[model samples]
Target: MDQVRVAVIGLGMGFSHARTLAAGRIAGGKLSAICDLNPAKQEEAKATLPSDVKIWNDADALIASGEIDAVIIATPHYAHPQVAIKCLSHGLHVLIEKPAGVYTKQVREMNLAAASSGKVFSIMYNQRCNPLYKKLRELIADGELGEIRRMNWIVTNWYRSQSYYDSGGWRATWGGEGGGVLINQSPHQLDLWQWTTGMMPKRIRAFCSFGKYRNIEVEDDVTAYAEYENGATAVFITTTGEAPGTNRYEVTGDRGKIVIEDGKLTFWRLRVPEPEFNQQYTGGFGEPECWKCDVPISGDNPQHSGIIQNFMDAIRQGTPLIAPGEEGIHGLTLSNAMHLSTWTDHWVDLPLDEDLYYELLQERIAQSSSQKTVREVGPVDMSKTFGTY
Candidate 1:
């Protein structure tokens, strides 16, 4: 195909994707159709999208219509895997929004479907396009920092108001959107944590504060500790209830340390590797000489548009995907481990027990309740809600 036709499924987060595609911002790609069951969302799309663009309420019909070669699944946390599976089964390229799914078992099934279908599968991990992170990953991969010893990210800048939760009935409920901060606002960081460092924790222990600062049924605050097989440790802390919050990620290695904060990347380079310095120095008071350097980040953060272009390029030109759909399970694995740790009051091991996690998640869903009144909200400038890091 010279140009890949694309359809966006959910109008909530998918609306932004639909608008971008409809505007023809992505070369080699055209917005051919949109599907949303909500009449309000459909009308909004009709008003905003071109007249020729098809609109449908049934996703299955859109997939079977053969009007598009690919579908961007932007539905809620649960429907992500379901819709992607259906689209892949129909022999369509699939790109779904973050967190993959509410649980790992379902995400695994979706990944299997993608593998069997042999279709281009990607995830909307827009933050991966951010130059800061791109450079960070490059530096780590190039061994600018030696073997990682510790990682800490305090990304609490995702502050959300009560009305934000009240705007939709599915916002924070376990039965609906799944979990809060970790699943919603912090998936990018969770993904980036392992993506940049090239490591997944061997075990995770987490403490999640359910509705600690909001009137919701899910976790709005969380602090997780993780240990890697290489003896490296990581700490991930996030919340949607703090004002004047901070976004800081620090990674320490034998060579030195790197910090990304305040939109700047800084590296404290050691004259000699710490291990070398420690062994060579006879003076007990002496430490490795450190020089502070401001790392230059020179590239535009194309964000969502970049990912779309990459997806289309992958379909039309056989380019590799920026975020493969199968990798979505890594971040979700960390997330599930956190939730399981909290639910079981114990540290959970890697290669998670998918059945046990599913069982526990079902228990939460069965007992889930939402008492907040829904509020009508206007269009959210989603760009502003992207990662603060």
Candidate 2:
């Protein structure tokens, strides 16, 4: 592959995307075009991008102009499907940002479009390429932890202030960004949860707190329970209100527990119990069978860069996507399930009713308190809030 020419949509995050592409982190990719509805943002992009790169106000114009072979859709959550479908219909490969679509039906439509177009359609779930997460999956698959029993994730470090929500009218509204942390910050964790576990939940029940941190109609704090078909259970918690929050995951299997936090993973191995103790401790909690411990993590890890490179490699070698566009529906489903469970006070099963989820969203949209024009929040300084991780 000489060069995988690329265009970017939504100059807010697209500016970052364009910058990364220009960095030439991807061996055979180049920033080729930029598109945004905001002329100011387009100008900002033009200022940053090489003079040869074209800028367009309309996505269709950019797609039709054929200046690039692929597009990176970094638009609002609601715009992902529409923009992806348009790009795919135009015979361009697409790499859409997380939360592939606001709902699964839109994702299905986009998937169908990609299938018909024979183009590589993938979601930007870069977390799946994280070295720690990859090692976690490998350990689980290797049966180092034995049969999986449960997984718990506390991912509240995604702290956001009311000012953050106030930064953009479209940010925390149903008609704009769809959901809150689940859609915005938790997609990466949600993708990691399922990706590392190598399983999907069969059912989910959750309760979400709205208007808890910001004046938003959607959830800012969510606690959801997932039940797997094999009788395994998982608990997921995410919040935007809690400062000095926690980012930790604990996976407990029959043999041991794997804990990951602050980019460090620790494994606690269970020791084998004596035959007499095993017999005497029936129906009770006691010491386990023979055990050992290890932290088998070592390498030159390129998390974000690894994912970007994977995208380029997938495009070049026709390899499978680490996170396929269709897989995004699972994370979306979990997020939607949390809201649905909270709104209706019910448990939601897999293959959620698209009409029902959309209906619930439409109700929230109707009642949404935001009427301000959705402006780009990029120009504002997020440097303080998005501190060094």
Candidate 3:
């Protein structure tokens, strides 16, 4: 198969994608073009390219270039759907950076665009590429964990400071980023949560704290509880303001519990209780140990590069995507549900009435007293053209 010519948008995270692709991490693909609004980024990228790469400041021009066969969009959360939809409409396979969209409607539109174009539409859920996670998912799928009862995702190591937020004016505001840790830093965790469990939250109740580090808006701390359809439950906790925080996920099932922390996957093997022991042990003040042991986890690949290569392989071989853009709706919906639950002081039910959520979101956006900030979209006046406020 010929090398798939791909163009990447947004120089921030997209730079790593470009570097990896150019370095041949994607065996059957090459980055033919790069787009960013920043002139210095364009100049720096151009200087770094291997002489034949094309750089453009306009995403539209890059999409219409006809030189690229696919597009990898690493722009902001809100921009992913718009750009990917455009590229898909132009018959380009798309790999969008996650959370997928700032809202559900956008994700639906992007999926429709992908379907109409009949091209690969995937999301950059790189964590799904982690071997530890792959093994964990395998065990869960094989019923190694039995019927999962509860799960907890405590991600605290994603520490962000005021300076991090200040690095880009658009980093923290509701309009710019849609949400904080959930959208920007925790898509990997959120995606993994749903991917491994094969469950979606039917209802969510959340509480959030804003502006602990910077003067910007959006929550830096969030604690949410979710209930699934099968009566299973999960707790998702995150904080961008914590230092040297904890990152741990524990899944408890009837057979055993699986714990993943600091890159180690440990499964506690449950002992089937003997009937004699169950009848005799009640006299004491203690209960029998239900499970024991921790499994050592070892094997990991370049996860981001792996996901990128997977996207390219799908393009070349017509293989099913590891994570489709449509599935992104779940994580995005979960995020919106959490935020909406917190904002409205009510439990947000799943299948989130998108219209109701959108109307509430519009009210929040209108009522938001946060100062506006804009990311430079090249030298063009984005004020009127982009309809960004």
Candidate 4:
């Protein structure tokens, strides 16, 4: 196909995708259709998008109409894997939004379907498009940081008010969006945490505060400690309730340390590797000399549009995807482990027990008590929310 005709499945966050594709921003893709169950959203799309773009309220009908070559699933958290699986089974390429799914069991099923379908399956990990993170990943992969020793990310800048929660009934509830900050606000960072470092924790111990700052039933504050198999450890702290918050990620290794904060990348390079210096030092008080270097980052962060372009390239020109669908499970695995640790009040191991996780999640869903009146809030301007990582 010269142009991959794409349909976006939801109008909330997917509204931006629809506009970008309709505007011909991505060279190899065309916005053929848009789908949402909300008629108001459909009207909004019809009013803003081009007159020729097809609008449908039924996703199943649009999927079966053979009107599109690919689908971008931007529905709520639980429906991500469900819709992607259906789209893949129909022999269409699929691009799912982040956090994969609420749990790994469902995401595993979706990944298996993608594997068997032989279709281009990807996730909207837009942060991978950020040049700073790309450079960070390159450094870690090229061994510039040597063996990783520790990682700490304080990403509490995702502050949200009560109005934000009251804007949607399905948000911040176990029966709706599963978990809060980890699932919604911090998925990008969680994905970047493992993706940039090329490591997943062997075990995770987390503490989550449900509705501590809002009138919802899901976690809005979290602190998690993770241990890696290589003796490396990590600390992840986040909240949607803190103002004047901080966004900092620091990684320490045998060679030195790297810090990304305030939109700058700084590296402290040791004259010698710490292990080598320790072995050679004759004086007890002497330490390896360190030099501070400012790493220059250049390139525009295309964000969601960049992921869409990559998806199109992968489908039409056989280009590799920036964020493959299967790898999404790694980040979701970390999320599930955190939730499980909080639920069980114990340290959770990796390759999470999918069955037990599912069971516990169901219990939470049954016990959920979210009755906030949802206000009619228009589509959020997502441009303001990207690249803060």
Q: Rate the local accuracy (lDDT) of all candidates.
A: 0.87, 0.78, 0.79, 0.87
lDDT of 3 by residue, 112-191 (tens): 88888889888988888787788888898998887888999999898877888877656777767777888888888888
Q: Which scores better on TM-score, 3 or 4?
A: 4
Task: List where candidate 3 sits over 4 angstroms from the true fold.
Answer: 273-291, 367-389
Instruction: Give the poorly placed runs of model 4, Cα more than 4 Å off.
Output: 370-389
Candidate 2: where is the Cα deviation over 4 Å?
A: 272-285, 289-294, 372-389
Give one digit per residue, the lDDT tens place, for model 4 in 48-152.
999989988777778788889999888877777877877888899999988798889888989999999999999999999999899999999999999999999
lDDT for model 3, on a 0 to 1 scale? 0.79
**Local accuracy of candidate 1 as per-residue lDDT tens digits, 1-389:** 89899998878788888899888899999999988877788888889999988988877678888899999888767777777887898899999989898888889989999999999999999999999999999999999999999999999999999999888776788876678888899999999999999999999999999989999989999999999999999999999999999999999999999999999999999999999998889987979999999999998999999999999999999999999999999999998999999999998999989899888777777777743211111233222221100
Candidate 1 stretches greater than 4 Å from native? 370-389
TM-score of each: 0.94, 0.90, 0.91, 0.94
Cα deviation of 310, candidate 1, in Å: 0.3
- Per-residue alpha-carbon lDDT of model 2 for 204-309, expressed as tens digits? 9998998787788888999999999988899999999998999999999877888998888888876642434566777776576644455767776665556566
Clash pairs, candidate 3, are: 37-378
lDDT of 4: 0.87
Better of 2 and 4 by TM-score: 4
Give the TM-score (vs. native) of candidate 3. 0.91
